[model samples]
Target: MRSMPNTNTRNLHELSADIAAVVRDVVATGEDAVITDDGTEVAVIMSMADYDRLHLYAELADAARPGYAGATEFRAMSISEMLDVLGVHPTVDRGLRG
Candidate 1:
């Protein structure tokens, strides 16, 4: 979805009163409204799905980096060897497995 670029910056007190309206607009328009504190960017209001997707993508990106925890080490294995190690037998006649 295309998002509108309208952003609302506010102090803590004004933000408390209008946060609901800002969040509603973000959800309705699939956009993020920036919230600031003491002239520094503090938070953003966005659609839940968009936020989740961005968060998941960041996690995946981090997981894809070298030395990331729980990252799969596949450089030393052939496809057939990987499948065998994973206990997945290939039923089809494809050249690659796993």
Candidate 2:
């Protein structure tokens, strides 16, 4: 989904009166509709596809920052090794046998 710089504005009453129509327009054009109340923007409506794409972009950006990396690797390890990595002690017997 692409970013829509040009947005349409609808007053609260107008949105409430014909919500389906407004939402249809938004989905059809892929443009956001700003819902305003008392001349102040209160909310926005956009298509689910656009919202998901935007959310993914934000997640990627957050992961790109230092110390914000996500867990993308997996490996098998022993219980003791897992405990050591977690910085904790195993107080109960895990029933592991050699």
Candidate 3:
């Protein structure tokens, strides 16, 4: 989320003690929490929306760069087409084809 842990930082023990509270805080704030172990960041807890946005951003950035495998074939396609290149077809994802 940030360069390093901020006020939202929480130790691993805090999670083991009461995960619900930590989760509630994250959802309420809509900001990820950095879960650390002995001052070292181990993981992050974030809302599903944030996680999805992160993945979409990553995919877009990865696809925009040259030599990304499908650049030539999908170069001029719309966003939906680019998604199909990644096998993430929104309209027919997860074998929902009919």
Q: Please list the Cα RMSD from the true structure of every candidate, rounded to 1 decimal place.
A: 14.9, 19.6, 11.1
Sliding window of 10 residues with minimal summed lDDT for model 3: 89-98
Model 2: lDDT equals 0.64
lDDT of each: 0.58, 0.64, 0.66
lDDT for model 1, please.
Answer: 0.58
Which one is best on lDDT?
3
Mark the regions of model 3 whose C-alpha exceeds 4 Å error after superposition: 1-7, 70-98
Residue-wise lDDT of candidate 2 within 1-98, one digit each (tens)? 22225478889987778999999888877667988889887788978875775456455544554565565664545434544554434443333211
Give residue 55's error in model 2 in angstroms.
0.4
Backbone collisions counted per model: 0, 0, 0
Q: Give the per-residue lDDT digits (tens) of candidate 1, residues 1-98.
A: 12223455557657888778777777776556777677776667767775665456555555555786875663554434544544445453333211
Candidate 2 residue 79 C-alpha distance from true site, Å: 42
Candidates 1 and 3 compared: the better one by lDDT is: 3
Model 1 TM-score, all chains together = 0.57
Models 1 onward score TM values of 0.57, 0.62, 0.63
